[model samples]
Target: GASSSVFSASSLASSLLSPFSSAVGLASSGFVSAAFSFTGDSTSFFTSSATTSACSVLGPLQHADYFGLGKLLSVRELFEARVHLGHKEGLLNDLMRPYLFGSRLGYHVIDLDKTLQHLFCALNFIAHVAYRNGIILFVTRHQQTAHMVEETARESHEFAHTRWWRPGLFTNSTAQFGTVTRLPDTVILLSTLDSVFEEHLAVKECNKLLIPTVAIMDTNCDPRLITYPIPGNDDTPAAIQLYCHLFKTAILRGKERRKKDEEAAARQQQEAAGTASDASKQPTSA
Candidate 1:
């Protein structure tokens, strides 16, 4: 009877401590969650904190209605690059009035939303042209953008003119512009036509030859001349860098797609030939 009483007392003590132990476990888990909670639309659980902190270090995030250009750079990054900054309000052209976000301290700011829209449109068109194996000639007389334009053309296996554009490069026939054998299918102007007065001849020649032109039009530049005008801060080094990188990337994507298509066609032809050969080798039942 005395041993049974001692066993019952030990069982009672075990039951009394079990609730406190469960509560401690639950409290520790709650503390863990409170201390390290992951927030944000990121798939990375470990790096989200770091990313969020870095983003906050810049400042509060501005809401941007992004379409597809986010892959190139976030809207915030575009803002940081000063792509929205434009010439003084007095310098803005009437045609570019619609693209202005508003005036800031006597200077007009180009709307980034409009910039993204036009940029995506231009990039898609460029990619399509590149896919067709068209010759793209980059022309930029502006000294600041010359190196980047040349480098971009080199990387994409295209052509570029960093120096003064020779008049009649496109419009003049082989007989007139004697050593040139061919002309480019498309022209990409890094700076607007006004940047180089001599380059106006190239623009006129492009129009005469029916060659499509893509131009970066600053707030002060006229947009009516180019086939595809991208309103942006073309003079900013960061903006130009973004433009060059994106155009090169788009061309590369198009070239890769074209190569894939060519390979697929070749494979299909080979498979058809193999099937025909196999059929011919089989004996015909009379």
Candidate 2:
């Protein structure tokens, strides 16, 4: 049974952070994944699997990849979706070099291993948020994929911002929306930049509002600005669709869990009420 606790930020902090902090490896997470396997090198910070177990050093929180969204896409599937293809080597951001597998011809190849790790973190975080009935907002500045992104958001029952962002949308929501508007607890950024040289202003505003962000960062985009960065080819329609499918599945799973928990809680309350009435009907012992 789900614990009878409100899913507040504090309740979810461990769930969201531990996975990412596990040295960029989701295999050690104890998540039930069927289609993927993590190489021993994924946990570079630890000795080979021959030596010590990943759980030996990590806490219980790290083992709680409860959503099991990791199994949604194998490295092979990601490759098929063109998720590993990056921008030209010349446009590569120095910060994102760590996620690069190597240069292929003139283009940089993203390390699918690392992308898988970070994607696990991203999917897990959003799932927990959905479980808590938190709001999610998807953002992207890519014109070619804007319609698809918005459609994904609608299907997932979330919000999207594909058009030009209004200044003070988050910073001054009350005035901008003509009333006190509720801000999203988290934001999913398909692309962090509006153009090759210009960064999206919402990135800064989200930071100012202290909203957590999960972003698909291309080679040329800086990953440091994102809370959970999945290094991949953000511009590819196929890649974006793959991401949408995985995230939507995760969110629906979270909501399903939440509904079950609520039903269980209500049943418990009704049972308690019936017991109280039976006790009242009996002669007073006192």
Candidate 3:
């Protein structure tokens, strides 16, 4: 029920952006370059100190409100994440190459990018849902090109501060894949469909009762295993690159929301403390 309301709102918002305008060239020329370049020192973008600080301030991901403030939606944030992620990895150039050269090779190349982009967009939609609902996002094989996703997420948060963003990264080894185990409260398992297809029955059974999965479903795999499947080419580097960007974008939007919530909580605490201190100093009621 909660997810349905959010989905309705997200769908409406998504429709507002004309399909053609979804292309990443809305801003000034060389916008692609400006957007992609993680801007001064990627380390600064997500310093070790910042990560620690965020963890401390936000507290453990386990105590987060899974069904309340976490489950919100923002279509624009999702789109921005996709564009930002793709631009960051130079995949945008590969994505656009087909359009630049209208030859047959270009057309085929473009198809892959297009499919990948569509999948990314679908995943973004799902991420928006998860973030709003305070769902935990878990990524299997964290070492496999996860940095690209994390970097884009960091950039997206830097730019947009909103209520539907909380970015998190998790590895599969630690993930207990049974009965929607709520370690992080809201778990979003991310993995390639191809990897899991061989164990289709098992994967299906795992996903059927618990856990909301957002998977990169390549042409070779069956879509049934994933709750939110983004269909595209699984083998191409470009395809993986594109999905990574999209995932990062969605995560960034979620993180932005968490930041806002933290700020609001701090303000409330400060005000409450101030009120208490002022009351203490006030003249006796008698």
Could you say which candidate leads in TM-score?
2
TM-score of each: 0.72, 0.77, 0.40
* lDDT tens per residue, model 3, 1-286: 1122122322322422222123222221111110111111120011134334544454323111211222222333333333212112223324233322122322222233233334434544444444555444444333444554444435544211112122221223234453343433223333443233342232343454444555554333455555555443334444456555555556665666656777988999999999999999989866
Clashes of 2: 0
- Please write out the lDDT profile of model 2 over residues 1-286, one tens digit for every residue: 3222233322333444555444234433333112223543232111234223442355323433445565575777888999999999889899999999999899999999778777877887788779879999999989889988899889889999998888888998899989878899989999999854477888889888778888999998887768888999998899998998888998888888778868987999999999999999999777
- Model 3 bad stretches (over 4 Å): 1-202, 284-286
Whichever of 1 and 2 has more lDDT, that candidate is 2
Cα-based lDDT at residue 271, candidate 1 = 100
Q: Where does candidate 2 have its weakest 10-residue lDDT segment?
A: 42-51
Residue 143's lDDT within candidate 3 is: 41
Candidate 1 ranges beyond 4 A from true positions = 1-70, 173-176, 194-199
Q: By lDDT, who's the top model here? A: 2
Clashes of each: 0, 0, 16
lDDT of 2 at 183: 95
Candidate 3 lDDT score at position 215: 58
Per-residue lDDT value at 110 in model 3:
23
Clashing pairs in 1: none
